[model samples]
Target: MTPQNTAGPLPPPTERRRLRQSRSLTHAQLAAQVGVGPSTLRAWESGRLVPHGSEGETYTRLLTTFAAEGVTAVDGPTAGEGASAVEAGRETPQAVVPQPLTPAQAFDELYAFCAPALVRQNYLLTGRPEVAREAVERAFQLAWQRWPEVARDRDPGGWVRAAAHDCALSHWHGFRSRYRRPEPPPADPADRALLDALLTLPPVYRRTLVLYDGVGLDLPETAAETEASTPAAANRLAYAREALAAQVPALAEPGELRRRLRPPATSEEVRAADPEPVRRKAERRNVFWTWAAVACTVTIIGATALAVRSAPTHYEAPIAPAQAVQGVPPAGVMGPLSREERALQAKLRSAAAKGPYRLVPEAR
Candidate 1:
């Protein structure tokens, strides 16, 4: 694949370093990108050692892939069904944005900032207690891939809420679309008259109502996250309220609606639970490093023992203490002296000038 325009960061120093930078990248998105820890990344940024090998290569691909996410065409269907017009020429693209933090750092920051709010929004929107959990999981998964973009925004929780809502809607749409079914409309007489009409309203109207009143996200923050103009967002929300009121009878009782939107109480243990993304990533890294440390320790100890065992070792007979030298073993006790042994023993003794030497060698 063509490398992403790494030429933007640090002046495209060299192809080798460019390649290394690519591998070192992480986005504020999906959790899969955080193979290394933040400390490691800091070390890399401060001109310490660069990450190398296949892992580095993976990082590089991520960097380049998003370099110009002109990844997919940014167009939609137009009124003219047969229009084939296309741009004949283009001006040079603007300087790339400051390279965002690697995906891991963004994930940690963004998830913490957004997840709680998204969970609340999920409960409010869907009216199902379990959906809040799934909504948070899926939202951050999408945000994990775009962590840099999400974290850089003024209100990350709002961004997260939109992504989470989309993920949940996509999930539901996929399920319903495949089944070729829609839920039976609300049954209460007031809802039967009004809620059915609300469902008939446009998507923009329904979504605006869900987000503004149902999920309790403010228009300005919601507009930023959803990429809607302020006037449009405000107007759509207004229209949505009218439609929802005109459509659903259950919506008439605001207190009842609020209670229905509330999530069921979870046990303290569950309430205190870590996000699945963070927990799972931590667990995976912890398990890997724990085994790695153990394996390395075991290997070093084993190697040292092996080296000690294989080393050349000569067992020297203990010298007799001067006072204890009264009795000594005879020379012929071990074996008859060979001429070479005699010569070596004589040489050794002559050097020390010991008297009446009767040296015996130990078994080889």
Candidate 2:
């Protein structure tokens, strides 16, 4: 049977299976042709998954090509019969399978797809093409060294973008910007004005603005890459937009600024890219310093508490009544006593008579 037209809605799973059968191609064969895993093709045929983004478009194009080519199944017994024959010790003609791309090949493809856009993103951040080129090159070089880890990442491009951003913000760039002459303005008046306005903003605001508007990252992603909280990123984006609008009224139009600032390439369009490099080293150092400071603080506090708890306390001994009165004269004085003293002696005699009295000889 002839293949269905691809201009209409996507063919159902049954139709895909029929088309594959008509072409005498196994699931693995078709998947290899399309540069996807055999399981992915099986999922598409089973209706368990639907391709999206570039994958979906690729599927449509492949299906269209398959229909146009009018490939037909070779004359042969059913697959079950062939398998049974093989089990019975009968040899079946083997089909040559396409080899999968190696890791190096995959890395090359990924770098080719993502490097240009990443370079553009860095350029926007640093306002210098040379700095941007160096940053992107450094990031890709690191990715090449850690290809396995980077290949497994879901958003490898994001990792590379963050690394390049850090490189652009490195201290060397600051020194260079201070000592070197500023680059000439662009020929376009609007472009020149926008660049000038962006340069005037604080680094945090500028980075937030470029990441959100120019790089097409969502608020949370921008915040993560910038190492800011979501709320803080939102605030920065709002302030940056307002500042840009004030300076360039044309930017006040919704999406106009984003359109003007956004790079020609997108992360979605380029599914593969490099890994993060310098950020990991910086993060490790930061973690070590933080733990060291915490340990020192806890040690000091514990020592202070132990010292206070184990400190010695002083107490005074109680004095005997006789010793307390040793410096005073006897109750009966030789010389005339003051009126108040005589009254005190009379009160003391009364108390002494009521209780047991003790007498001590007067000193010579």
Candidate 3:
């Protein structure tokens, strides 16, 4: 359920910016804390939009904390005309209007917003910083490859997170020599123990625990991200928590368990590459594969055409094999002639030399 607003009306846009600056928080950091996109927070600070509902309450509370810390703007209205307007209880009816962003611009914003935390989460998922970096880069590459679908997604960050998690936990990595052996353990004993426990859990359970506890995703969101039923996800989370607590007794409490599920200090080494290079590499790969497919198709077509051109047009019968018979003489053997054949030959020889005469009547 959404919590009620106890922080009262928010100060004007200018004062909110001043308060945030005084606390030395980046837009990303503050937005993360307030459960909003950096762009939304920027809108709040610029007065193009106003915070309301649960988000408004959270923003007001955070600003109140800053104000309580003795950060104040001298020229801006703290309790002046701007505060009076807010106090007058006038609610702005305008929704958050997203500015038009080109594909490149939108992609860059998403990368900037999600990359750092993705690296950290992937590192926690896989104990190796190098592997974490590789998974995140690969995931972003895939995202760029399918940017049209990903950009249209309702939860783009969640989509990227799921991709990275799957990459990190892939069994295919076992075949590669680099990922065969385990990486070195974390330096601190507690971190090492926590990591060891996390690594021991089944991949699905580990992923569920991380999404729910480490990343602060609610049960339903965690289930949706992990592609599991809500009850199944809840059960996995329970089992994972029990196993982790067994390994590290200090993490018995739910709060403590969530706290310890962070990336170890070694995560400092895990850094994602610039988004520009990842996008470029994805495009290059897509182009290479496309040309390769076209070349294969052309080669097949040429081979088929050549075969048809050279093929014989008619069929010829094959000769039967020679067979041997007992009555037949062997090859190249001859038999003597019969007496009747010899007599006929002698008669023809004796009647030669024009001995037979024919009578013909002469014409008158």
> Which candidate model has the greater TM-score, 1 or 3?
3
Off by over 4 Å in 2: 1-98, 177-179, 265-364
lDDT of each: 0.53, 0.69, 0.80
How do all models score by TM-score?
A: 0.35, 0.50, 0.65
Which ten-residue region of model 1 has the weakest summed lDDT? Answer: 264-273
The 10 consecutive residues of candidate 2 with the worst lDDT sum are: 265-274
Position 31, candidate 3: lDDT:
65
Residue-wise C-alpha lDDT for candidate 3, range 1-364, written one tens digit per residue = 5344455978888999999866645664576677655667888899888787776789999998888976333444344566676677763224343367788887887888788788888887888888888898899889999999988775677778899999999988889998888788877787788889888999899899888877667677778888899999999999999998899899889877766654332434667889899889999999999999999999999999999999989997999999866687668657786899789888777766445563445799
* Superposed model 3: Cα runs more than 4 Å off: 1-3, 10-99, 262-267, 314-364
Per-residue lDDT tens digits of candidate 2, residues 22-134? 56455544653454545677888898887655546677677767676664444556888978887887766665554666876665655665677677666566666677777
In candidate 1, how many Å is residue 94 off? 48
Record all residue pairs in model 2 with backbone atoms less than 3 Å apart, i.e. clashing.
none
Q: Is candidate 1 or candidate 3 better by lDDT?
A: 3
Q: Which candidate number has the best TM-score?
A: 3
Model 1 Cα lDDT, one tens digit per residue, 1-364? 4333332343122543454344443322211242433334344444454544443555456445545442344344353432433232223224444466665765665566456645655443443335556767766665655566865664455566676777655545445543354444333454344434544667556566655544544566447556799799998876765665555555556544433332321111112125555547545666787899999999999999999999879987889766655578777667689999999998986766555465656698
Q: Compared to the true structure, candidate 1 yields what TM-score?
A: 0.35
Instruction: List all candidate RMSDs to the true structure.
Output: 27.1, 12.5, 10.1
Give the Cα RMSD of candidate 1: 27.1
